[model samples]
Target: MTDAPTLHFGVFEVAAPQVGGTFSWAHPRSRSADFLDPQHWIHIARVLEDSGFDFLFFAGGYGYPLVDGDLPEIAATKGINFSAIDPDYLIPVLAQHTDTLGFVVTLSTGLEHPAQLARRLASLDHLTSGRVGWNIVTGASQNAVADVFGQDAIVPHDTRYAMAAEYVELAARLWEHGWDDDARVVDRESGVYARRDGVRPVVFEGEHYRSRGYFGAPPSPQRTPVLFQAGTSPAGRAFAARNSECVFVQATTPARTAAAVADIRALAAERGRDPRGMKLMAGLTVFVGETEEEARRYEAEFDAMQTDEIVASLYAGNTGIDLLALDPDKTLHQVLGQGSVGEMGTSNIDRFLGENAPTVREILDQLKGRGTRGFRLVGDGTQVADGIERLAAETDLDGFLIEPVFEPADLEDFGRLVMPILRERGRLREGAPGNTLRARLTEQPGNDRLGDAHPVLAAD
Candidate 1:
């Protein structure tokens, strides 16, 4: 049962650079393209599609909430940092150009009305030809709160998940309940665009939001975008167990990752879910070369290339603690704080990073590999493949979100060089390309819709 556990080879689309968005290796020497150059995505989409990648996602967050306490450096480097043409807009451009690549976009449940999310995501699925996926994220950063809601206001962690529960409930209803499969009958004789009896509005009234549903336009190929969640907290994990078709996790050690995987699957079982159906993806970064010596040199190049201040800003932004103010070696708990690490209670990653509390230099070294605060893998193709396989063997993860060090080339190398090994070893997903994101992922039809065990479905 564990063989070929469905690897989702993907790349994070944020254009990460050095401090306050200092300078990134991705675009350090080249002319910056519009939206970091169309070529950047074009190459990315093409490579991921050809390499048997399950999807390529663009992560989103609201506002540039700079954490430096002084926002100027972040402000100045905004163009260079991860500034983009927006993931929603980018998905379509890539969709027209690529065949099998799925595109996932991150959307915050906290800020959107369910009706709007439903409509937008459904339209995206149609536009992308059933290859769209939605990453349900509750806002994490305090600055996101200030930008999306207002200054000095933040919701507690559990409550946000509570709101998230309702948000997803409403969204699922909109996407799944509104259109029955038989709704679209184009009999030339009747010539009606849609059957009214087969289609009806979905309604939701809840504590967080209330919507009198207007059935969002015509149903697309897959009405609901593939469900995904990345929160690792108890509340977040519970949410993933119930709703997520795929889950994202991060950890430094194989032991930590293995423990996390067990916890999530346990909760999914506790909730009476088919734990096997939920594919878990660990976020990872890989720096590869033809030989081990070459790989070491490449790591040195990336190490030499980094600017300390930028790494500091990236850390500050993620931890929500001003790096300038804290003792580099001290635990965040030692300093103690008011809100969650993601604006809730302390986060798992924060605690994990805090364990032994590596100094500033160590944290930077770790991050240089994954870009964000996730796992790092560095080696040649054989070593890289072995490392990924070992992570799967040790942690029991379904697959991973492979964050890239360089643009098209890194992804190109993986799909071209690395993925085949995964496939040959049967560590990756197999079979013909699927139509909908969920179908490709789960390999089951109708399962695209939320099952009865889900809390939202129960309410319905």
Candidate 2:
């Protein structure tokens, strides 16, 4: 009944202050809001569900943003951190409140064994009554490696993806092929409810990890939980195209977004997948009001609340460049060569800002365009919906990974005002929630495991 194409919208959990633009932590002075308070998140999630969101993603990492080798400036401003509230456990709390709101939790293949991660995610799926997703990440920063594994040697870029490939495959085996439909039944009469022959043991021994035998639990609603991928370097894109059901893309322009979507879809086609099956969700932030001028006024107010020094500090940590040490005029080309290359993709410093270093005043405004790797829409409800629709239509993106520009209120507006328009247009999911994250986002069959198009689906 709507004109918009089938797309599912999900909220991208912002770690601190402003949802879209980098804001302060819960308390800038004390930073003390407990990350596990389900009440706080429930307020956000309920708005999303009422406003028509398909899911809400809780994203985090083990370490802080160590981009350019500095944290003091970022820390003082209470900008984003390398550490986040452990969020997997929050799923049950969130599920206890809402029925259709799916949860996506980030865990990397580089850190743990497939058995442990698979069982954990499966348990979440079980506890959440089947509304859960697993975001597959390769370690983005070495800090996490040092912190989690107590090893300082970050794996090489290509090697990280290589290990991820193996990790994802092993997970598929444990979740998909390990059990049959009738593996568990707590019946008292026959005394034997489980069919032993039906539950198969998966034996995997690769260069990185090896697994022997069946998984610990019976299948959850979504066995492999929808696999979400977020990297887009050449190797990164390849990994996503092969294993990912949902792709989170960050970019600055609608044109760039269109190209990225086409690029990934082409890669999927080369792998013999129906390119349409891959859902490309781009980053976005919004400010809304009864009128356009009012929305503009709101953005200016939020921008005033932002501390540029703190923003730069986060930029420094994320890039590993020690921004304070260099004069703003110093070129990025020079700084990167001088051992400032301790981090991963600094798209803020690389693609958008493009110079090694620019003066604060001249560069700070420029930094806004690339923060989340997508266009940040600022306007009233109608205008905001107009822009989102434009981005989706022009770029051919499936939907958005919405970030809040002003914490709870920013999210509140999107759900209240913009979402209905999108839902009316068919730009957001118009259907009832599915049993699993995969089924909710995709129209394809609910496999409860990796589909045949995924590389992991063929490894056995």
lDDT tens digits, residue span 149-198, model 1: 66666677788888998899888877777787888888888787678888
TM-score quality measure for candidate 1: 0.89
Angstrom error of the Cα, residue 265, model 2: value is 0.7
For model 2, residues 389-458, the per-residue Cα lDDT tens digits are: 7888898988888766555666777777888877776666543555566777775446455655576787
Off by over 4 Å in 2: 14-21, 24-36, 67-70, 76-79, 144-148, 337-343, 346-363, 368-370, 431-434, 444-448
Q: What's the residue-level lDDT of 2 in candidate 1?
A: 45
Candidate 2: residue 5 lDDT (0-100):
83
Give the clash total for candidate 1.
5
- C-alpha lDDT (0 to 100) for residue 75 of candidate 2: 58
Q: 36, model 1: CA deviation in Å?
A: 3.7
| Residues forming the 10-long window of minimal summed lDDT in candidate 1 | 15-24
lDDT, candidate 1, at 410: 59
How does each model score on lDDT?
Answer: 0.69, 0.71
